[model samples]
Target: MFAEIITIGDEILIGQIIDTNSAFIAQELNKIGVSVYQISSVQDDRAHILKALREAESRSDIVIVTGGLGPTKDDITKHTLCEYFGDTLVENHEVLLHVEEIFKKYISSPISELNRQQAWVLSRAEVLHNEYGTAPGMWIQRNGKVVVSLPGVPFEMKHLITTKVVPRIIEGFKRPFIVHKTMITYGMGESAIAEILEPVEVRLPSEVKLAYLPSLGSVRLRLTGKGPDKDQLNALVQSEANKIKALLGNLIYGEDGGEPIEELVANLLIQKNMTLGTAESFTGGRIAQKITSIPGASAYFKGSVVSYATQTKIEVLKVPQALIEQYSVVSAQVAEAMASNLRALLKTDFAIATTGNAGPTKGDADVEVGTVYIAIASPKRVIVEKYLMGSQRDRVVQKSVNKAFELLQKEILKL
Candidate 1:
């Protein structure tokens, strides 16, 4: 089954708040074998909301509206839903009791009239109790399609969907089984990878499909299969995945959804019982930040030195001043020295370093914009490589960081 998601808020349109609810709801729906048809963000204006709802119902079997369910005046989703359903707003005693208890126990204040109005819901709707908030979720059935109204608060919306919406969907409709498998590959652009996988794609079955999700320096290949038989569908997708893996080989780093590059590196370090350190020039401490973002990193991560300036590289990472004079701070020689010194100073078995000229105007070096050098210091040797990332400053820094990890991963595997 397919569903459409509408996020009703002026805040989302004005960029005051991000519309994360659509993503969360879509993922949840996908898990239950329901696909999202379209997602829209409309202002809190009544005409816009009504138009969006009408359009959504025309295209999808289920329409989920989030936000605009608050008790305040700008919150009109509840009233709009009632008008659409040709129903009236009525006080629900059970909802009122829950709201009162929440206030008395948690909020510790007398409920205002505005807060009490949260108990008034669509007369034709089935109330979805909100254990965490004042606004109750509404479920209405019209002409065999489902319309659900939920609070915009992420935590409360998540609770209502998990506890109420999903169960009702399963109980009411028959859904096909959907299976997804993702594999990560680095060092190759999407066009290059696609050229190799074109033959494999041509052979994929009708029910199974391949999608490429690309990022800075990597691409994630996801195989999604849908059918009545879960095991058969899973096996079909896995069989196709094996074909892709056979063609890609070691180019594929990790698989499934949790396979972030940093997490993969962290796991490998833990497996080998090795410690890591980083020295940074253009990337700042971002490499260390990505590594430490994973839990249990303290066990394998030694430390980092953000040698962002020529003096800092000389003073902190102990890169020789004479070398900076010979080859600028953004050179491969400086990057290699930074890595090698960081490995010895931090007493880590592995070290990664980044030095680059990411520039609108060159700060220290006269090199062109996007010139980057990434270095890795292993137990046996130190290696550095250069690349021209792009003209964009942020892109250059991020691509440098990704390339650093790629170089580090290759070195780790050598050990």
Candidate 2:
């Protein structure tokens, strides 16, 4: 089945707010084996929204609309949908009770007439109750197509879709099985990876497709397969993934499902029953923050020292003051020293350190704006690498952090 998502908000059109609702809706729809034909964002104006609705309905079997569902004056989705479906507004007692209960339990202020108006839904549509908010969702079927209007608020829309809309769609429609496999690779650019995977891509089955998604210093290779038999589709995807794994080997660090390099490194540390720490300079505490973002990180992650200043590197991390004068702060020597000292200070089996000049201008050390040095100090030896990233400060920092985790993961694998 094919679906279309329409996000209605002047804020999105004007770039004041991002349309995250559409992305979430698309992912959920894809999980149910529904292909997203098009995603659109329209202004809150009634005419624009009506035009988008008509266009989406013309091409898609399922049209999901979000936003402009509040009780405020600018909220015109319910009224415009009523016009589209040729129905009138009628009071729903169940919705009214839900709104009343929400107001009585959550809000201390007395409910106004506008809040009460949330109970009035389209006469011909099925009222999908929203337990999270006052705005109720509408499920309208015209001819053979389905139109589901959800609240613009993300949580409310997500709750309704997961609890009501998806179940109903599953019961009403039969969809094919879709499987996706993603491999995370670092220390290589997209162009290089694509060149290496050209033969593999050409040999892929007709049911499977390959896509490369790159960010900063890493690239993600995603393999998607579609078929009627779930087991066969999964096996095909796995077979293809194994082929790519044989080609890439250690360059591929982890898989998809939010397991990035930091998570991969954390899991390796936990599995080996070893602890880790970090000493960061130019990357700011990003390396440490990524490590701690994983749940139960304290079991393997000891702590981090953000020795951003030269004096802090010397005083806190115990890097020699003379070494800073010798090789400057943004050199590989200082990165190695920082990592080794941090490992000793924190009493961890392994440590990762980063020092770089991430800026629009050259640093006091006379290095280029994007010059970075990352080091991983393991129990046996210390490995250091230098990189000349782009001039963008955020990009340089991100690349440095990613490279640090990648290098750390590589060293941990040897253990």
Candidate 3:
């Protein structure tokens, strides 16, 4: 089954507030095997809302409307819905009790007439009680299609959908099983990865679809399948995933939900019973931040030193001042020295180091901007690589972090 979402608010169109309700509703619908046909945002004007509702009802099996359901005059969704259903307003005693209960719990003063009017709902609709707010949800059926009206507040809308709407949809409709699998890849652009997986993409089954979602330095390949038999669809998705894996091999770092490369490195360190540390220059502790972001990181992560200045690198990390003079601070030699020093100081089995000029202008060392050198120090040996990233500072830093993780993963697998 398919559904359409309509968010009614002038604030959304005017950029006063973001419309996060549509995304939440769409995700919930997908979990229950209902595909979102389209998502739209309409102004608070009654005529615009009516047009949107008519358009949605003609194409969707179910229509969900949110916003403008409050008791204020600008809140016209309830009245517009009344006109659409060819019905009139009537007071519901059960809803009035719910409203009064909510007021009694939160409001110290007497409830006003405007708040009391929240109990008046359309006579033709079935009321869906809202435990979180005074405005109750409504469910209406016309010509065998379903229309649900909900409050604009995010928490209240979520509660109503989770408690009342989802169960009803599951009991009322027969839906196909849907599955999604994602694979994460780094060190390659989207078009290159697409070219490499062209053969596998062309041979995919009709029910399975492939999408390449790319970020700064990585691409996420998602495979979505829909079918009546859950096991068969899962097997089909796995088979296609295996084909792509065979073609890509270690280039595919991780899978499903597109886990970051730092998580992969952390898992590898834990499995091997090893510890890790970092000595950073240009990245400015981002590598350490990413590592510590994973829960229980202290088990395998030692610590990091952000020796940004040359004197700090010499005094703290003990990189030789002579070495910095011989080769520039952004040189591969300095990166290797930083890594080796970090591993020795922290007593870790492995360490990652980065040194570079991440900026819009060239630094005092006479090196061009985006000149980065990353090194990995393993128990057996130290390896370093040089890269020329873009001129933008943030992009350069992000790319450096991604490359550092990729290189560390490669070295970990080698051991």
For this target, which candidate reaches the highest TM-score against the unseen true structure?
Answer: 1
Q: Clashing residue pairs, candidate 3?
A: none
The runs of at least 3 residues in candidate 2 whose Cα sits more than 4 Å from the true structure, single-residue gaps closed, are: none
Listed in order, each prediction's TM-score against the native is: 0.96, 0.93, 0.93
- In candidate 2, position 290 carries an lDDT of 86
Which is the winner by lDDT between candidate 2 and candidate 3? 3
Clash list (residue pairs), candidate 1: none
Ranking by TM-score: 1, 2, 3
Which sections of candidate 1 miss by over 4 Å? none
lDDT scores in order: 0.91, 0.91, 0.92
Per-residue alpha-carbon lDDT of candidate 3 for residues 193-277, written as tens digits (9 for 90 to 100): 8999999999999999999998777888999999899999999999999999999888898986656789888889999999999
* Top-lDDT structure, candidate number: 3
* Model 2 global lDDT (CA atoms, 0 to 1): 0.91
- 1-415 per-residue lDDT for model 2 (tens digits): 8999999888998889888998899899889899999999988898998899999999989999998889999999999998888899999999999999998999999999999999999998999989889999999998889999999899999999899989988999889988999998998999998888888999999999999999998899999999899999999999999999998887887888877778878889989999999999888899889888889999999999998888899999989989999999999899999999999999999999998899877666789889999999999999999999989999999888888888888899898
Query: What TM-score quantifies how close candidate 1 is to the native fold?
Result: 0.96
lDDT of 3: 0.92
